[model samples]
Target chain A: MTTLQAPDTPFLALDVDRVDANIARLRQHLDLLGTPLRLHVKTAKSVDVAARAFGGGTGPITVSTLAEAEYFADAGWTDILYAVGLDPHKLPRAQALVERGVDLTMLLDSITQADALVQHCRTHGVTIPALIEIDCDGHRGGIRPDSADLIPIGRRLADAGCLRGVLDHAGESYFATTADDQRAAAGVERVTVLDAADRLRQADFACPVVSVGSTPTAHATAELTGVTEVRAGNFVFFDLVMAGIGVCRVADLALSVVVTVIGHHGNEGIFTDGGWMATSRDRGTAQQAVDQGYGLVADIDGVLIPDLLMVGASQEHGVLSIRPGSSRRLPHLPIGTRLRILPNHACATAAQHSRYLVHHGGSTDVVSQWPRHNGW
Target chain B: MTTLQAPDTPFLALDVDRVDANIARLRQHLDLLGTPLRLHVKTAKSVDVAARAFGGGTGPITVSTLAEAEYFADAGWTDILYAVGLDPHKLPRAQALVERGVDLTMLLDSITQADALVQHCRTHGVTIPALIEIDCDGHRGGIRPDSADLIPIGRRLADAGCLRGVLDHAGESYFATTADDQRAAAGVERVTVLDAADRLRQADFACPVVSVGSTPTAHATAELTGVTEVRAGNFVFFDLVMAGIGVCRVADLALSVVVTVIGHHGNEGIFTDGGWMATSRDRGTAQQAVDQGYGLVADIDGVLIPDLLMVGASQEHGVLSIRPGSSRRLPHLPIGTRLRILPNHACATAAQHSRYLVHHGGSTDVVSQWPRHNGW
Candidate 1:
């Protein structure tokens, strides 16, 4: 096998076996729910890594940027949903994708965006599939299903022959403290999007697709009678945030930053070469009951160190400290000691590097290097 | 006059004229202090952007990673210092740069690291210059200036013929709220590094380089009689954090993420196509008296929107809300209206993109595309 070390002090490492298991676990749940998975490729922005999640097939995928839509198309994946609300200036790139025989779908929640897409289609003589974003839990962007503004925007898309359906993400599901809470959030997400889809159909807009998901909600969902497809990205490499929400356990984390001990402060903390630049500034856990400062420390073989957490960071330095009130002695990790750090949010931390050093679950041997489509 | 805009909604925009003015402002201050500037390239990471600071001549620079050290070397720059604490695994990359005739200097603070560098030099018959980091104000990494451990660490490098002098960064100065507080921090920075150099000299070591800096201290230093160089990177593209520290004004910020209005919630806030992905999760201003949530909102012409701040963000969504209790009616930014969003930390924000969209001051015109050295 291709096995070697990076020689650099900090790099991202991915456990392929763990990745496969996480994907299989989520797929089994969706299989029972009778909904196919439209894997969001935003978390792992690599073609090779996403291929592992598909298990040797080009599954339907969701994207956060046009760059991913074009990149996956070039890599021979056909179906894609550009999930972020559309900006008018990006219609050209969306046009190029549709013209190239790719099943490109755009998303929007405003009449202005719908009008822009209609105008672009008329200007270029093309058809770009689109979906209306429905806000289920008031997390961020999306139109309310019960609002009077829904049918007008749907009428614009339906008249332009571009309406796909309705989709809603239960963003609050990420903070659900129990499996029952996640399940309730998932059910609310389905009802909200299905309500919008039913309203669009009542107005004679053929709403064919109904989508619902978020990492926590995807796994917690037990039924999907009206949902056509579930979309999720972070489940393929579960992070501390997922674990905090009770969706997954700490052992299921598939991604980590490999760093080396460089120095130490007197009774303050141990310093590692990895910093916010290696790990990201995504302190997603800061809002949780117990904030894993930046991330939890693990050994090179992916074993968690007891009560030790990354408490502070600068640009290129991380301070590892024992949890407060714990009498556990600091481990004798001298200079040049290699360790793995599990991140709080996989998407944020994974974006810090351009490639991933892949290994199997039982071995630290390098198996491959997967490049990411990191920037727009 | 290359003036066509990026079809993408969110991209990094840099003001070249503002960059020149910021660089010149610091140079003028350092000129009175009799110290040359060793421009730290970690912020912009773009050769074109750094070229603006040098004014067409190649000046000495400091880097945070070996990839930067190698990249700047290939671009024909000579003197470079890798400013982070060194890990022994990176010795080969450093040796390769030294072999390629780049004046690369490394930093470290312990005996184990010194012995490793010595072993590598002895095994390969090559000399690698290095600096002993001194801890001033109980910061992250570095030995105490008066500690007896300093002479032993310095003696290792002096015996191996690779001793350069001492360096200390007044990292705590970033929190200073007054010019006097910043100046006092700068004064302490100087005394600490020079004190370490004096200790090395007493041990019969010829300490040649004496370095001290941080963005706030570099601007606050009024005298540098014994200091040879001041290293500061964020000064070239000041952010809200520096503004909060009283080091610069809000108008002095030169980098921003230009985004288009995508959607909006009823009374919560306005939504943009940019988010934590575009503006990074660097909430550096949270510790300040006035927490600029993620960043402050600005118009396309770099004018501030009154009392508007980015209060919340997701992967591809930013919510612009009015500061609480402000009666300023929310601006009527319809869909497709483009605006600039200033960042909380320039380095973290700049790392989100692969290239910069360069323009000049007082004119909204694209002049160039400068690529950045983003990943390790």
Candidate 2:
């Protein structure tokens, strides 16, 4: 029963109960899908925060960088898929991990990298597993799902005895307007990974895992037909972006920065210590009908002051203005008024701080301080 | 010189020579204006970096947070202005710093904060200097430059004999498009502080210092007139944003992330490990031009790849796409080809890493590591 003492200033708060609920909700959905959840670690940055999503099991994990892979690996969470394509330079780190008995699978979308990785592995007297990245849609990385590239790369890796399976991240699902759009994106992800898997199988390659993920897609496409594992992140602490994408309710967002009102700019704006550097420059999914500039300003009870939004920000000050067409000067916020702000991107926002000051309402007990990882 | 050597990976590099050059340039300009340069520490989070900027003296610095104020103060660099507006919760931290003989000046913008600070100072038996923040042109914080509000706040503090001077940060000058625009912003900043000083003087209050700054305006406004001290942060490592505002040249940018090529998407694109998380999601000022997506992509030598840009970015993957009209497939970047990425916003970009890998071409060295300060 640890909690942060109420300070009249800005600090990041993690509601452990809300976090558990969010994790349960995501797990329930994945359970219904009968797909293993390979929780993505980029969102939380903290090994402890990420551990909550695992629910006390040695679940497989997805990482965006070697730094994350090393972090989780050091924390005894070894089954990791370095999701970003790898270069030869990472071979040494990968070698160190594998030699230490960690199950590490590198990702790649091109042959040049594959050949180089194979050569590096041969030279090092070690073999590393790899997943051939497939571009389900033009979101970010990957080779075309139906392209001739998949078979060659998949077979080449299999020939090297290091190919794992095919993977695709439906990043576009973050922009989905509705559950159906998310489901559609998820459906496409399944089709893309399964197609690549099928192509590899036809070429006599053993394709075991057809990985598909994106929080919105993972939840929406509960019954991904061919996907063996669902790799999703950001569901643990759903932000305004996730809520805007119809993936979760605002109340489901368990993490927020507790900032204090420091001053009032005339009668128009209230200034706080949370700025772009603290809250991050993420405007959230504001390009849609629901625009959250930076994030939604909320009270301690997690109730959104719909009329108040972080209208502007400097390095260390957030200038919040009342929503247009609304009257009242944002409740006079008053100097020393403590409030929680929901971030747009949980990952980027979380990265701004060194640790999370876990809080339980009305409690003075010191909870746990979760450390975060930084650098490459 | 501490070089963050991770083979050919995209990581931020700080060149001591170029940093010295940039510091020298800012010193020359500040000398021309006949004002002491209170180097802004937000841009370079390193105490060592600030020490280099202060090559002349004990170094009076401006910090964005109390954490930084504490860091530099503990590191023996005493004079600090917590540039951002202050909160009462941090009053204890300030008092502790003052107790340690740190010349700390807390910023106040409203009567409410002024009262609270006064109460805190009284309760703790600590006498701290207070600077009234005046809003020059609403670029960031401060009471309006010409408002009656400025006088009342100043007079109240002066009446209590706690007021030190009036301070203004012309942050809007960062957005200035031309020399005239910078000069105009500088004028606004100068007037904001001078006018507040005038109001205090007219009221028979001895307001000695009038502070105003922003690199663009600091360099452009030669005649400080009544301004006493200037504070500008980003001049330490000129960024792409500074270049876009005509404040410096791209060649003048001294910080960049050296990234490794992981894969290539045919002639369509090339992928690297330096994604938004590495280079930061800041599109810089060029966001108005072509939306450099993440930032301007460069080779290992810091040469901008002609017609090339970071077209897409995820957590750890940056997609380098040649402009649509350009037909050349980049000369085989190949896996492990090291490339340097010029940042969009140096402050945000620099803050992302734990320590800087100081470098000066082939001079591999690890001179110092600076911990980044987060939270209030």
Worst 10 residues of 2 chain B by lDDT: B1-10
Which residue segments of model 2 deviate by more than 4 Å? A1-8, A327-329, A360-366, B1-8, B286-291, B323-331, B361-376
Error of 1 at B319 (Å): 1.0
**Tens digits of per-residue lDDT for model 1, B125-162:** 99999999998887778998898789888889999998
Model 2, TM vs. native: 0.95
Q: Residue-wise lDDT of candidate 2 within B132-247, one digit each (tens)?
A: 88887766667875676767777777766678998987878877889998989888788768877887888888887788888899888868878888988898888878888788
- Per-prediction DockQ scores? 0.85, 0.65
For model 1 chain B, where is the 10-residue window of minimal lDDT? B1-10
**Cα TM-score per model:** 0.99, 0.95
Interface RMSD of each: 0.9, 1.9
Docking class of 2: medium
Reference interface contacts recovered per candidate: 0.83, 0.72
Residue-wise lDDT of candidate 2 within A1-376, one digit each (tens)?
A: 5344365356678877778888898789888878888988888877887778776655689988788888888889889988888777778898899999899999888877788788888888898999999988777778887787777787778888888899998888877889888889988888988888888988899988788888888888856777889988888888888888778888888788878788886678888888888887766565767787888898766677878988877778888888777765567677777778888888888877777877554443447777888766
What TM-score would candidate 1 get against the native? 0.99
